[model samples]
Target: MRNICAIIVVFFMACSIPGYAQPRHSFALGDSVFLLDNRPFQMICGEMHYARIPREAWRQRMKMAKAMGLNTIGTYVFWNIQEPEKGKFDFSGNNDIAAFVRTAQEESLWVVLRPSPYVCAEWEFGGYPYWLQNENGLVVRSKEQKYLNEYKQYLMALGKQLAPLQVNHGGNILMIQVENEYGSYGDNREYLEINRKIFQKAGFDGLLFTADQANDVARGFLPGSLPALNGIDNPQRIRQLVRRYNNGKGPYYVAEWYPAWFDWWGSPHHVVPPEKYTAQLDSMLSAGISVNMYMFHGGTTRGFMNGANYNDKSPYEPQISSYDYDAPLDEAGNATPKFMAFRSVIQKHLPPGQTLPDVPAAKPAISIDDIQFRETTGIFNILSSPKINQRLLTFEDLHQAYGFVLYRTKLNGGAKGKLAVMGLRDYALVFINGRRAGILDRRLGDSSINVEMPQGSVTLDILVENLGRINFGPYLLNNKKGITQKVLFNNQELENWQMFSLPLDDINAIKRSAAAKKYTEAPVLRRGNFNLVKTGDSYLDMSRWGKGVVWVNGYNLGRYWNVGPQQTIYVPGEWLKPGNNEIVVLELIKPQQAILRGIEKPSLSN
Candidate 1:
């Protein structure tokens, strides 16, 4: 009887159901479908970035993804946030990606990890750490040896945190991407292969793939690896491109299906109507193709980390801090009309025996109508000790990433002629002896201006704003922000300059500056308070204020410009309290007593 009972237990263990069984095999590429335990698998993936959302709110976001009928979640590991300085890395706090992936696993969702060292997600420097600009003669996203060595180190560090989490090791990561969308910038096959070898060397045993736009696949495709397409939901076109470039063997995947678009400063706010995407989604699901929404949810681009972009003949357009991206889930994590429409589409595509969880309850949002400001300060209120240089230096040269840099020098013969600032990163507010002279805006492609000098020696000051660093294309190699080169008066270069570093990546120092001076510079700060019996999410109306940045209870909410599209900065309820909450605004100019109000919905693309 004992022997018979033991035999029964063994039989049950061996005949465990597939649902209860361990993943028989790690995810692998099939000839035309992703194979799981040698059976075909359809990946319904949604993309979200851990850096964009609050650390405390990560698990809730994961639950939302699962509730949306997605079995897979995709995210790009930001190199700048992970390894801000060379050889220095931070995986704690909101930068803790390992914690994020584990949370996804707990939520029963698989992960597609895209660790783009050069992720052009409208992020600063295209996700490259600004310090990379300091590397002597280094060309990023290239086959350059110096760059590859550094890139190799970064990949290894990431692997240590993520490799064990892959499906091969009993974790949930399905595959990891090589570099992000390289073909759009160049046809560097050697560089693409190098990235593959680096990922392999880092112990990534699951799978590796490259993502590129459909037309650029031929240029970006790596031999012997899977190819992923990013763009509109044209399943047929992507299928053909992958079959042609991937040797006719494909599980055709749409890597970045666009449901919404990104925003830029001074550009109209972007919104992609839900109807524009529903039909395409239906067709892809009907065809059984795997799809990953580029921005299933876009949170926010807090801090000075938002990137800027420019063309050969155009001005610099910095990305706004509110990444919102007009995704299904808005910046504040509230579901929109599009979210409801998208839910039905996802529910229709689930496989047999699968069902989506009900949508989570929406977070409450409150409106504060009578907010008031009581204190103010100027940007140049407190100055850092200056570094002397024969000519102006770039931000990277000073080991700084983002913020304002002040360049001051004296002219013995009084400056004259066209005052040209060689390689101005973006914008500059020129002032002479503490008075506004003129403006040099990169958006208008203006770097030099006519200056009429009066008799005696005069002081020349150029407060250059490192609007953002370019994160994509050929220009990415030389994206050293601030004054990249020397400043010139007429045809001659200026000398004996004093440069100050004002990287406002941290607002603590700025808060102290606000205490010293009420108003001193072009950009200024205004302080106020509002009360609430309860706290939730809200949008601070920027319709009345000029262009600048905002902070709530010491948390920087990002930038605000009167320029339409995104006029209100999102304020998370997590940062609020029941009784009193303080609000601070960095008003660049035009300071006055203004009444501020908080609203429930966003006013992007103002």
Candidate 2:
């Protein structure tokens, strides 16, 4: 009787435990469908990025995904965040992608990893390191040997962390993606083939697939690999596209179905109603088509990691710090109406006797009001020594990736006309002798400003901010922040400038001023502290503040502007301590009030 009880216990354990009890399984791409352990499987996946979400909240987010009836989680591997500098790789802390995948498996979910070296997820430089621009004649997302070598090095390093997790290796990773949406970039079949071989050599020995728009499948498709579609919602269209690309076979997959959209600064917040896509989602599932939501959750594009978009159709539109893509799960991992809409559709399609787990509770939120600044200092107070040069050097030339840079020069007495920075990358604040002059914004195509100088040798300072590199379209290669061209005064080139690198990666290194300086239009750093008795997910409302960046406890919480769209910065409670938590703000423009507050919910709009 004891032996019988033991056998029954083991049987229940195997049946109930999510991933712990499952044995090693085989996942293969048959001619018609995906087979998991010799049985046809439909992948209901949701896209989430590890870099966007805080490391502490990864497990809870994955559990949320499982409860939403998602059998798989899709994620993009950002190369820039992983390898900030050439040959220096960091795969720990928030970047511990191996841990992210393991947690997904622990929640009984498979992973479809998109480790494309060039991922245009509206991330900076399309995931290419800014230093890549410094390489001589190296074109990214091409067959350029210099770019290819760097790509291979990054892929190999990343594979070391994830390749072993493939399903065949007793891990939950199902397949790996090649170069992302290459069809939209170029019709380089040769480059696509090279990318495929690189993945195999890197030890990814599972089904490899290429995802593209329906029309792009022909160009981005490589022989002997699955062709997945993106944004194609119609069931018949999906089947037709997959069949055409897969030699008249099956296994139709929609890799990126965008239920909603991402927003940019100065634009209205993008919110799509659940009714728009609910019917399509239900139809797709009823037809047995595998689908992956573009962003199940877009946590946040914290720090200077946000990317921008530039082309003929639109002006320079930099992505806001909040990556809340209006997804099923909101920015703070709270399930939305859209979540239930998608979950309802996904739940109906589950196999016989299979049921989704209960949805986890939303992360707790606490509010703190009337946070006051204890100290303030000028932007120049934080500057170190300057690199004086004849010609203006870019941020990359000075070995700086993100953040602001100061370009200072002395104009001779009465030496002023239309001050023109020929190629101002993004935005710049002009000052004359410690006084705010005018603004040169790339978004407005304002490079030259009419100015009159005093009859003394006054100092000219142009503080340029890297809004974000161009992430999409043909202008990607031309992304170099700071003054890329000659600075001209009245059409004559200005020279002998002093360059200061303000790569504010270490906010703690900044020493606050002993006395509070008089608040002016010039940029200033405001420091404050707040004690938290309890900690949870919260948003720091920047509605009362002007243009600036925020840092809580030492983590850079990205940028905030009075501009419409995103008005709060997400502060993960894990980054906070129960005692005194420090808060720092670098305000470019003087706000009416130096007061801030921690609000329970996010105020994404103006």
Candidate 3:
């Protein structure tokens, strides 16, 4: 009897295990039909990058997604921000992947994780660490051994955090994408396979897929696997790509349906009407195709992490700190009319007994004002400057990635005619006797220009601005900050330049000092102060000033440019004071005066 009981127990356990252990749904290929767990399951997702949104607002955003009738949340994990330094990983605070995944789970939402160490979301360096470029002969996003090895390390690290959250692991992560939109770059089958292997090795044995625009699917989509379409607006294109890539499988998905766009320096503020996006959403839903909004919440860029885009010929165009992608959720986390329209459309198509949740209330906005400032250091108080190849270094060297670097050299020949730089990365304003003489822009690629210089023991100041780095394409891989070569006058490279490494990672370092000095070397700190009575979010207009970095109460607002597109700087409300706020301005050029004003809106071209 005991033996009979044991056999019955064994049989019961086997029967229970199959129900729990079966794969969430096999993404199988078939003619005219696609299956999810052998059943048709449509994905309604919303895309929102975690690093861009505030941690405190994650739940609210997820709730917002649910209210929009989204069953899934698609996110890109930025490798550069996650692991700023190689071997040192960070998943805490805003970088927490597990927190984000679990929050979606609590909201009964599935997840699509796009771990593209190369997410070109208008991010700084396209989400790549500048240090990676510091290495000799390091080619990114390819089958290169060195690049793959580093890539593997990051993949394994991310896998450790997310592998357990997959559907098979009792969580809701439904699909994982290979590299993003690779067809735009090349047709390397070997590279795509290697990426698949890495994901499998990292324990991500769940459903794997690839996303690309509709036209690029032929070259971009991997054969015999799930192919998701990105940025597809028309139903015909979506059907064509889905059938073409998935062997006529009918379940199609729009991986990145853009409802809004991003802004750069000198461009007007941007806004997309809700009516257009509503029409697109209605079309996709009515056709029974899954869709994910590119940016459900377009949040702030926060720090110096904003990137640029250049296609080799053009100058580097860096992105603005305000990532507010004209998304349904604005930079301040407020839901716009687009959010309501999307929610209504999705509600109209829901199966029986289902209703979308109510929209969440908007967060309170802080107000700031009444500011005053004072200066403590002048240009002459530097000791020495850093030189490259025995020549005074340009902003490209001394390893200054962003912001301004000051270079001072005593003129032995005295300033006279035709001052020129051998190479100016983007833009530079030259100064003689603490006065502006000329400016050079790389847009023209004309570094050699005439400039007026004064006589005997004169100080030559060249303030260089990081116009921005290319955030997309092959040129993105060639982004180099500061001056590439040396600055020259009439073909003679300037020497003995006093260099200042003004990356400005710290705000407390700025202090009150009343001293007149000169340096023959590198790393100089300039101090200044500004006052404020009330407090609110504002933009500091940095266009009048030459290239350099500005700090309000020690918060790094991001690089500024005299160049068009992004003239004004973003100053967050949290960085302001109720009364007098200290403003320290570091100018790499020779300027006699500094002036600033506050603007309520972002300055970007529409």
Per residue, candidate 2 scores C-alpha lDDT tens digits across 23-126 of: 67898877667899999898989999999998988988888898899889999999998999999999999988888998888878899999998888989998
Question: lDDT for each of the candidates?
Answer: 0.82, 0.88, 0.71
The reply for model 1, stretches above 4 Å from the true place, is 1-25, 412-418, 450-457, 490-492, 511-521, 593-595
As a TM-score, model 2 comes out at 0.95
lDDT of 1 at 128: 89
The TM-scores of all predictions, comma-separated, are: 0.91, 0.95, 0.82
- What order do you get sorting by lDDT, best first? 2, 1, 3
Kindly list the per-residue Cα lDDT of model 1 for residues 1-606, writing each as its tens digit.
Answer: 999999999879865532233453558888878986678888889888999898778888787877777889999999999999999999998899988988887788889999968889888888889888777878888888888888999989998998888887777888888878878888978888888888888888778899998878888889887899998477677678888988887888889999998888778888889988888888887777899998988999987888877777666788888888878887877677777788788888777887888889988898987787777666667567898988678888889888788888998655468889888887787876666667787877788988877668777888888777887677887788788777888888888989989876666666444533322345666778888999888998888887677888888788777765688888888888998888877775455545789998878865
lDDT tens digits, residues 243-300, model 3?
8777677567788899888876656657789998788889888887888888887776
- Where model 3 places Cα greater than 4 Å from the true spot, the runs are 1-39, 312-315, 374-389, 392-400, 443-449, 496-498, 514-606
After superposition on all C-alphas, the RMSD of every candidate to the true structure, in Å, is 4.8, 3.9, 6.5
